[model samples]
Target chain A: MLQNFIFNYIDCPGIQSKNAGKVSTCAGCPNQSVCSLSSTKLANPEIVLVHKRLSLVKYKIIILSGKGGVGKSTITSLISRTIASENENKNVAILDIDICGPSQPRVLGALGEQVHQSASGWSPVYIEDNLSLMSIGFLLNNSSDAIIWRGPKKNGIIKQFLSEVDWGSLDYLILDTPPGTSDEHMSAATYLKEADITGAIIVTTPQEVALIDVRKEIDFCKKVNIPILGLIENMNIFICPKCKNSAEIFPALTGGAKQMSEDLNVELLGCLPLDPLLARCCDEGKNALIEIPNSPAILILKTIVQSNNFQLYIFLFSVSSLYKFNNINYLKLYQEYF
Target chain B: MLESVKHVFLVLSGKGGVGKSTVSSQVALALKESGFKVGLLDIDLCGPSIPYLLDLEVEDVHQSSEGWVPVFADSEQKLAVMSIGFLLKNRNDSIVWRGPKKTSMIKQFLTDVVWQDIDYLIIDTPPGTSDEHITVMENLRNVKCDGAIVITTPQAVSVDDVLKEITFCRKTGIPIVGIVENMSGFVCPSCSECTNIFSSNGGVSLSEMVNVPFITKVPIDPTIGKLELRGHSILKMYPDSEMSKAFSKIVLEITKSKEA
Candidate 1:
């Protein structure tokens, strides 16, 4: 349902753009080496389909963390659930492109749910009436089965997830990516370059090792020109339920995310503590906002979504007028890094 | 380094930030502490934390007649280390390489890298089962791959990913040596009381579900970070700590012969 002319081809010089490797717009593009000769040469054939399918989505937010296990899927699930619950009228969906270790189905409590296929496309499993989730988890025979795929196979699956899933007229499409700036991240970025990407929300723990990877992730975003919304520091501290005290679980040796954000000049949205209750709720796939409404982690998340100062609340059911959607000016500042 | 290296244990995880590199370093250090020559090959090229974890100084990969020479972690030249971390001109250089580049790099690492006949080669992989993992498995298909030691945290999310990893091991024919549940609980520095901040037994249940050996549970000890920061021997300096004891148990199990 995308307008055929929405995709502006000024940046890319078509398929025969001499060498895509030399083009700044083609940097970090998965098709940098092989730009297939096809329809109009505006983009790749699959990417054109991707644009056609995802043009209905208003905001496409990517949840990325170069370092894994820092709660990328957890935060994506929570945000989609929160957005859907906060606004009853809006339609929100999560597209989990983590082909190898897709956990969105399990995280959203929709494990073992099958994605039905109609004439249009594959239907994402509905976690709630307005909130739906799609992942390779739903397609596997067993939830425990491994997807032992190499690069091309993984890229194929990612394309199907982006263009084939019938995420009909979504207000927000949150994409949960795998760790590292590898196949999945590049494919998603390249295919969705012109999909009116709202921005990316980078997640990380407070540890220096984790932050080091996060810096790589920032570089990747700049190389791909994905405008970053801000950074969310996850698992900042561990608060004990029994002793009523807190501890530095990962121990931010190098001033943690705060210092990194200050040095890198990226917006620090807020920090969420390591709450046991929230972990238990996520383990059971229960709604954190409902199960542990008063927990510190949820309170911080609520503040992030409710506060007007920070940018997270802007993605919420805010007014449509104050808009500077993919301002190319911001990406130019990081072009030197590319 | 020994003349006849025996075991090559791959410390793996399905999710990131679950301390895969830390666990790999601990296991390798434990083997070295036990007087076994060890070679730690860190294939997590994107974020090779091994050099930092082992407190290795920034050094170049010198190409010898055999292949690239690995750096030594100890003065005794017992523990050898190779990582993409050492090849970078700048430590902050982001490895934004694609799959083909990564696969070729990994192939070069496996074919090259003068391990010098160490008793063990611990390959620390990046999270997930992608090209890097497949390339590793394919290249090691001919070798006597000992087994894989899977690492997971107590969180259900981590447990969920571990299940898929177990499947990957099963499909790849890598015997599951055991599973180590890392960061099971946080020990308050002041009160010394442990709390299940991540919720315990997820690793235990995962191991049980897959019928793999549940190695041990490592709790949150901030001192481990200090040891890692100072590049101190994890098992040697913190032998009395709970983490050291847990890894000692893991090393014991992973080092056992297949016939045993």
Candidate 2:
């Protein structure tokens, strides 16, 4: 594990690596010349700094989906808000690592907010005294401007978000990632590799198309050694508001998440049906519990937070990689998630 | 080299899983059924859902003297398809490449694919701004493209992300063909009543705000969601359904806008 560690940073062989420059991975890598050198490996200052910052964070949970628009950001917002409101004493923060399309700022209703750099680092924008957020949205001049960058540039910001963001100290830090297991996912996994990442909550819509990506995302988590906390199937059914006739908006031709979860051996945390009022809350950036008091989706979200898997895993997480949703920091996870 | 492609447009969205592939597949099929030689480029390399949606998942691309021969959806070869999903060793073998590999793959798909003499090329991208978007924009900079068909659901978050997508298109020089509000509502088959289950009209307001054409609002059509109809294009499969009609209208708007 130690030998394979460091994600070889940018898939490079690192400075002084025996396979540097000559390996197929370095074919187009710009740092081939610099990385090909043979010498004693100097400890990366950035990794050391990131470790320093994240050490203060008790529980680190990343929200991921191999597919887009599966409600990862929405779930992150709902869970974080619920946790912050419920556990007033604990600190909770969200790190939006979706460089191209950061959703946390808007989802948390802090879209136009700015990040302030203190002597410590960039202070996260506060939503509540206990809950704050750090997203690229706050840095953009206009929320609508495209962050048209390639992999390396995106990785740079993600690193900044991790090492530079001043969360002070957080009981929970939920990182929201964009769709696909590419640069952003790689960057997050690499930086947070040794950050004692709690586990990831995988979000997906109940359908074969979305499930296909969910499977790949699961594969990614396993490859990166990030424990799979559980799988969340969002928008499972749509009940007509008038007739109350429920229909699968996205038909599970291939058995959807239930079959996939069973096959992948990952926990199926809870299923949230598609509700219009809840959708309205996400769009309006309002708390679903407050806005749609009787919403069924809220009921499911509650179940997921209280789900024994989520609670039980926090404690067992660091003990063994054999388990999923493992070693959850129950108190902190309860503070950040519940 | 894409002299065969007369007009190239992209199926883009700010958020993922909002049916960018669904729209791209149906629109490509609609154009093909209308007798236009269409090419569908699935540049959403990582999550290449187009092959599965279009039921061409089993088809494989072959190398030809012209370049890579695209798999045809129909027997007549009117609809040509290229995607990273096709090059996979197996069905579940995900493309685990980072930005560089994905960027190079998109470039290869653009330059190596032999979409000889196509009327319209629809590039279906993965949601959000990334290397795939940049590579496609840089490569297609010289090509004559009709612009992009931006898709979204009737939700605020999707609209928010799509605004960034619109800005991305503007900065990259791709014009906006229109905004499509997809998965807007659900129509119960038994009750025959419509419910704004996903909310409503987020795309229309977005179009108005961005000053792009308002294409069409496609409801959540369950008929098309059936597993058996996975590879069947909505236009030919459910030609009489409300969803099919919306797709046809979308095609009408695209052609109309291009002509104008």
lDDT of 2 by residue, B99-135 (tens): 8998888889999998989888988999888888889
User: Against the true structure, candidate 2 has what lDDT?
Assistant: 0.83
Give every prediction's interface RMSD: 1.5, 1.4
Which pairs of residues collide in model 1?
Answer: A68-B16, A69-B16
Instruction: Please write out the lDDT profile of model 1 over residues B103-202, one tens digit for every residue.
Output: 9999998887888778888999999987888899988887878899999998888888888888888888988889999988877777878788778888
Residue A39: error of model 2 in Å? 11
What's the C-alpha lDDT at position B137 in model 2? 85
Per-prediction TM-score, please?
0.89, 0.90
Number of the top lDDT candidate? 2
Which one wins on TM-score?
A: 2
TM-score of chain B of each: 0.95, 0.95
Q: Name the runs in model 2 displaced over 4 angstroms.
A: A1-40, A319-338, B257-260
What lDDT is reached at residue A176 by model 2? 89
Cα lDDT tens digits for candidate 1, A1-338: 13222332346655655554456665555555676434334656798899899887878889998888888988898888877898899999999998888878777777778989999999999988999888988888977878888888889988998889887779889999998888888899998876657778899998877887888888888878777777899999877666777778888888888998777777788899988887777778888888888988888887776665443334431323323443333333344546
